[model samples]
Target: MAAEQGKVDPMHQFAIEPLFGSAHWEIAGYNIAFTNSALWMAIATVALWIFVAGGMKRELVPGRWQMAVESFTGFIDDLLEANVGKAGRKYVPYIFSLFMFILFANLLGLIPLPLALAGVHPFTFTSHFTVTGVLAILSFAIVLVVGFWKHKLHFFSLFVPHGTPLVMIPLIFMIELVSFMIRPFSLGLRLFVAMMAGHVLLEVLSSFVIDGLNAGATFGLIVSLPSFLLMIGICALEILVAGIQAYVFALLTSLYINDAENLH
Candidate 1:
């Protein structure tokens, strides 16, 4: 659909367009062509690398770039230490990369670039459940592997909390096990829904602004003005939400790892 049609189709932003000309690579009957989502993810990865690389310049007096990187490193370090104690330190590299990757991806999607002229647009891969689900599963898999490897069969004890009544052990174990299994779904859904909802709302309000302004002066003043203001507020809120979601994902992952590392 044309950009003009986006005023009607709020979901146009979320469409996954193949980068190549209508050609899809298929293996085992599944299409896996290069897409805008993959492109954006690659862009995010490169951006992150540049950001970290810039901060790698060690100096006698640390510059803003170095300080900024150190600040984030310390923040993640403290978060993991608080959650999983000293053992959590080992997982800092993974957790930090995960947090920064999500943060960069979320923020990159919100950039209002003038790429429309180039037939290019910013895409939020995180808005898709597949992307988020893979991330969640990665974290969950680490927890499972670590738990089973370190604690052996005792990892199952994580499902049974301390001081449970003997009679309620069966019921509590079932409930806890179910909840444990649901973690990946919930983790993925939370980020996906949050990102998608914010973008959809912004698109809808943008459409209203365009339509109202095009209609008449009265409509522009009554509808477009308010919608424009609300859109600005939502844009700001979404930026904040972007960071919060990254933090929440990393924090929860650390906490989950704590269950594995310490069995608490």
Candidate 2:
């Protein structure tokens, strides 16, 4: 149902609205003010800075904070080494950066801010294609540049697997080429859709429970209880999804780099 008459709109949370007063910034009569999405992005960037920098101190005896940071970093390091091998260690910092930024962006969206704030800026910019797409493009660029830089013409061999019959080579190359070209889209879409869907599901479920309670019937209250519990479960699952999506993105990046560097 449309939210025009005060109905719940799960998607309204994803809208892009002006960050400040209207008419403050415009071009040719079109309002182009800074958006909440932009503000959240800036916030995420600042948060990343504070967390990473603050946790960089090397303590003689690591405190809980220090240990937590070290553990997270070690996990990222292991992910890189597992997917991309020893040479991949060189890209650890970059991979770790990608993972943490995405992980935080996903988690931030789960925060239940005021309805007014959420309507203007949900703070889960990663749920938007533009943000995720940019990251995907960056990953694609790294793979492309590294592929060509390391292998020259041999990089094209990535589109052709080994141990293939001569007759099937042409068909296989086309399939691989198409898959390779759309990596960025797939990478970004996976995260963007997953984040958006999880949030929307939670909102829709919560609305159902609220509507049930408002019905003023004993059965409504009982029904709402189960729905409420389900909503809580979904929230927990989204938290897990947030981490998994970030890991998949980073792992895919590492695998792409590996393929580019060590192509068959």
Model 2: per-residue lDDT, tens digit, 1-264? 366665678887788777666526979987667888877877777888887777788987878777878888899888878877788888888888999999888887787747546553456888899899999999999999999999998898888888889999999999999999999999999999999999899889877887787776775678788888998899899999999999999999999988876786
Evaluated with lDDT, which candidate comes out highest? 1
Q: What is each predicted model's overall lDDT from 0 to 1?
A: 0.93, 0.85
lDDT of 1: 0.93
TM-score of every model versus the real structure: 0.95, 0.90
Worst 10 residues of 2 by lDDT: 113-122
Off by over 4 Å in 1: 2-6, 27-29
Supply the global lDDT for candidate 2.
Answer: 0.85
By summed lDDT, which 10 consecutive residues of candidate 1 come out lowest? Answer: 1-10
Question: Candidate 1 residues 205-254, lDDT tens each?
Answer: 98899899889999999999999999999999999999999999999999
